[model samples]
Target: MFHQPNSEFAVVCRFQGLFPDDIGGYEKHRTRNGGDLGHVDASRSHLNRRVIGNADWAARTIAMIEDMKAENFADEIETLTRRRRKKQLKHRMVEGPRDPWRATRHGPMREVILTANRNWFDAPATSAARAARAQAFEDAARDWLLANFGEDVVHARADLDEQAFHIHAVIVPKVQVELNGTTRWMLQPSKHDLIKNYEAAQDSVGQHFAPLGLARGERRAAAVRKARQTGDEPPAYRQHVRTADWRKAEDTKIVETRAELEQRAEAMIVDEIVLAQREAGMIARENAIEVREQAAAGRERAAETKEQEADAMLAVGQGLAAGAFDIEDRDGTPALVETPEAKPGLLSKLRARMALSSSGRARALHVFSKALARLRKQSRDEAKTAVARDTAEIEAADEKIVEIASRLPDAERRSIGKIRLSLSARIMALTGRNMARETPERGGNDGRP
Candidate 1:
């Protein structure tokens, strides 16, 4: 059901093309990975690798090595990957020592990293069990990297401590001729390209277990959705960056906009005043007649009612009345206060507020119970949301990885690469012909897709 794994782990891989001795090249490339995050190599392999059984030993070895050397892979790989859709921009994260410090660099070193990870993980039952699981993942990762990139990977090993598990690979680009005497350009795959290959490898791994009734695809999908909603996320700047200044700027813009609006309102008011001026005389004459008629109607009502409630009079023609009536009197009561009584503190003359009346106290407990129930419900909702987020992220990562991998060049799919090239050439040739046939007055556009 799946073409690749939606793994809840991050992996890194680096590759360097071999240099011939005749080219005045040295062993610098072999030692490059060792210098990367040195702590990874400092661990005693005998003890760590022994933690896992033979069945998972290879998996554990690779995971540990990858974790150690990940730093050398590249910085801000996830950021770069996310920005890929922008098309026009290459996400280059500028880092290093601040103004005063800088690290030494040998040769013109450049690298692109491809990282794969899900946001959630399976919990361990015991320390030994956790160690065994870790060992298995690392071991498998080691073999995976060598098998995909080549056996020459033994020359590189990075030490990232235990911060994360990722592979580091290095390859210096140079031209070389194959046995067929065809000279080819040496190059490191782009980040997008490398991830494609990695995902393809994972697809192969998943299929091998299919006959054993192990279905990886479905499990990965469910786990990914669960991880996404649980907030088991990779580090993202949205969580860390503050937008207060942006909001403040937006408020200022609104204030300025309101000032302009006020000017517009003043103009509108003036126009309204002018319009009223044009209609004022006719409007006043009509209103006067209305008032006179209303007055006559009110007098008729007053004469009819007599003295039952002397101060009351019937409403006249919807507030067009000219006749006045007496106001009611409630002269003895104290005037009502508009302000609330303030609570006193310290040595103020006002008496203290009682902690609570018996009924008030009982009501307070009822309110507390309601609040507690609400809080519990809120907590459950939050937990559910977090789990869903984690799950989504994992699913997205898996699908993207698989799609890229399916397009990569693998052992059985090497011929697929030729197919891609042939198709691309045919497409380009047809496109050129179409463009040539089109009128110059018309232009190409994005609606094509």
Candidate 2:
């Protein structure tokens, strides 16, 4: 029976570097249909007008980064410690010709286009049904982005104007992470991480759309493994040969016995299972290490935040005492005050005045201390919770590791035995066939081509 075409989901992930010179071109392509520049194709246009969420702010953002770097270079140099200055000089010397605009290897933005097999939408008879399918696909794409990248997803647009309906998303690489007991923003997720996330997103999209008759696309590795097990030419190889030619060639080759073929297939299956188990063990160890490191970092951040808050409160109290004063107005009402010349502005003056009175200062300090204390307590609590969660995760991973390790040896041995048996039987059959064929041609022991 002929089966219906499966709706397969795919995500094409590309990281285009927003160089200083290429920014204009990218911006043009994103904003307008290039007339003579040919940045965008107008011939196959389906869009009547600009769609929502199709703005080109990424180039502008990259330009802002460049401008900030240039403007702050002197300030950065002045603030750097002696050791830091030396390290910076060394890095600049070693890493030659760095692009000011491209901060990371994958640059500042990531573009992911999520599309599915065209047949999925084309098969719908009604325009409303087609629109529904398109909306479903876009929704799935948006969900994948939010789940994977969270706030890092800068912009996402569903472009029905394209030949195939797809969602185009731009993601900034910035992420807030705790490093050395401090929360800081950094450009995260290298190209490798992006690819990993993309692969995971593809799986999620498949799961999300599964009820709607969409399936995940087959992975290249899985396809290769299947081809190996089947002992047939893979799709890549089939591209070079016609089906009729391939069939005729296969007919001329000596076929293995059904029993031997079955044994070999079983051996391959067992081998694959054992390999998978080993991989699972390795992944478990890696996860355990990652979780432990995260827990350690969390504890450090909590401690650091507590220390920083204590220091800040102490400084505020010291500053208030050193700057305390009193001023009597024309009405002879004594009011706590700060020297107007000493303070920067009205806000600073008000703050200083509030800190001058013993009662007001004490109340303000108490409120400040309470807030900091609450923050510190929350940090500690979160750290503890993280530790507990990760601990459980690691323990479960360890159990899986142990279970897989225990079963792997026996599985490997059985697979090896089957493989040897299959090989020996195939060799014997080949020899017997050669002998039988030679017997008929043995009329003369003459050498022939």
Q: Name the lDDT value of residue 204 in candidate 2.
A: 65
Question: lDDT (CA) for every model shown?
Answer: 0.35, 0.50
TM-score of each: 0.23, 0.40
lDDT, candidate 2, residue 431?
53
**Tens digits of per-residue lDDT for model 2, 81-127:** 22356566334322211223335555555666666666766768888
Cα lDDT tens digits for candidate 1, 245-347: 5555677899677656655677778577557755985797899899899989987876654321211111110011111111111242211111112222311
Model 1 vs truth, CA RMSD: 42.8
Q: Model 2, residue 398: what's the lDDT?
A: 53
Model 2 ranges off by over 4 Å: 1-23, 35-56, 67-108, 176-186, 191-194, 225-449
